[model samples]
Target: MFVNKAYRFRLYPNKKQEVLIAKTIGCSRFVFNRFLSLWNESYQTTGKGLSFNFCSSQLTQLKKELEWLKEVDSHALQSSLKNLADSFDRYFKKQNEAPRFKNKRNNVQSYTTNIEKKNQNPEVSIAENRLKLPKLGWIRFANCREVKGRILNATIRKSPSGRYFVSLLVETEVKEIPKTASTVGIDVGLKDFAILSNGKVYKNPKFFRALEEKLAKAQRILSRRQRLAIQQKRPLSEAKNVQKQRIKVARIHEQVVHARTNYLQKISTEIIKNHDIIGIEDLQVSNMIKNRKLAKAISEVSWSEFRTMLEYKAKWYGRQVIAVDPRHTSQKCHSCGHTAKENRQTQAAFICVSCGHSENADINASRNIHELAILL
Candidate 1:
């Protein structure tokens, strides 16, 4: 099976190289926005959309027109154009969703270059790490993870902190493990993200809560400087301060994201390894958030991220995951198959009205999930 994996590489460049990196990232964003504008215009006027190749040719024409465009390397420019075209292709494939206009935001985009076809191996030496592009010269990145499979593409990016990193996508074959005999079910909640059927309760790390105060402080500082800058007719000092504030906020956000991602990775790896078939409740986050009492706690969680982790890790481990309707997972008595609204009293205890069976509320729900999975 082909798996999508990302490997990060650290970059150390001189002042001149840093400028080039900034320009390259900016140029790529410009190209993406320019192409998006053309695409929407074409759709509005001719009622016929352009293909990836056609959009790419337009970018090449525009590149030739700009004097400073020559400063960026040629291959990099072409790669940027290609990446934009691919973005459109993927967007249009999900035509039901409305495509948003590309903004000049930091994440507006980074740059991508095909690595697998050009480089025989990712473990290439630093001397060979240099990648040539349209206006950019040979840029090199030291090896990190062993490029076990052919690299599909590598993206070059300048993070909000003004740091640069490259993310690599590789294609490789993995053997599926023989079927395992164990199965498990998990019930997720606000306090503990999940409670397993075997009476194991996993607490919710609440990644967002840990960073909430810091983010709030950063936002306040950002707003103060932003307001002053607007009032002062865009003072350079204010502009610089605002940029600093934005980076501070972005750093905290990134840390929280990494922590959450790490937690989910650990949980998913455990779930996939020991279980052949896993069952979980299909939670409607939006609907569940209506409870004003728990909204603060609910907002801190990333249940959807957890679900995604389970899905991909399960695939990696040659296991399967099934999400069943969450209708009575909490109220239903696993022992007697009795579901009653009154069975749940407070947040901790579940007492079956019909069977008089009592259990820890979340644990009972998880047990019910396991029971339902075994039935299937």
Candidate 2:
């Protein structure tokens, strides 16, 4: 089956290339913000937003008037317009909030450029340790893995930690793995990342909590630097110390994210490979996090990210991932089909009053989820 996948790599550009990258990001941001303003104005006057075709046609004229816009990659600017259009589309569909103006001071900045194929040869290709871009030419990047499939586009991003990375989106064929004929249900919790119907538990690593103290210390120093910059009547960006400390704090957060992502990837892959039908709770995490006491714990568990990984990986491996209604999963008795608040005597244990059956709380929940998936 054909699938779209993204391969991300660390980029190490030369001083000139870095400057050009910064320029491209700035130009892209400028185009998006400018077009967004026009879209808002058009909507206000005519009760209709500017269409992609109209905005795209106007971009040519805009570049002509703003000579600096012509300095960066034109494809990047067009991509920026496309992204703005997508944002509006999502907003109108009530899938996201309304599009907002891009700020230059944002911690993370990115620009996407389309890949052109000439005589069946793609302009964007990885050669040895370098990647070819539109106007930036070949730039060095960490060649950690072989990039397969046809390259569609490349997105260059600068992280808050002041690190440059590139994400290449490609279309490729993925062969499904051999079916294992195993079915499993997973219940995710703060204590354990997941508990399978087979009574197996994947412990939550708590990556953020592990590094919270260190991150807090770094952030405290950064806060002091920011206050010092303000006291001196200087912009935080202009203060070298503030910038350095900011990067340090960003790096700590980055480390936590990387660690959590790595763990989730491994676990998701294992589950996908072992089970033909995987059942999981359909958790409304956004609403769950509204409880201030559980917000940090829920965020640290990263259930959404884990579920996303499982779903995409399942599709790639020809496995079915079913999300069952989470309501009463923990409180319901797996053996007797009894569901009541009293059934959940404790956080870790469940005892059905109807049949006097007992089981681990998460295990009972997973079994209920498994049965629900079978019914579906």
TM-scores vs. true structure, each candidate: 0.86, 0.96
Q: Kindly list the per-residue Cα lDDT of model 1 for residues 55-156, writing each as its tens digit.
A: 767766886798677676555666766665666677778844544554556452467765444534443223455544323445666655466665666677
lDDT of all predictions: 0.75, 0.92
Where model 1 places Cα greater than 4 Å from the true spot, the runs are: 73-76, 79-98, 118-145, 177-179, 236-238, 290-293
Give the number of the best model, judged by lDDT: 2
Off by over 4 Å in 2: 118-120
For candidate 2, the 10 contiguous residues with the lowest summed lDDT are: 116-125
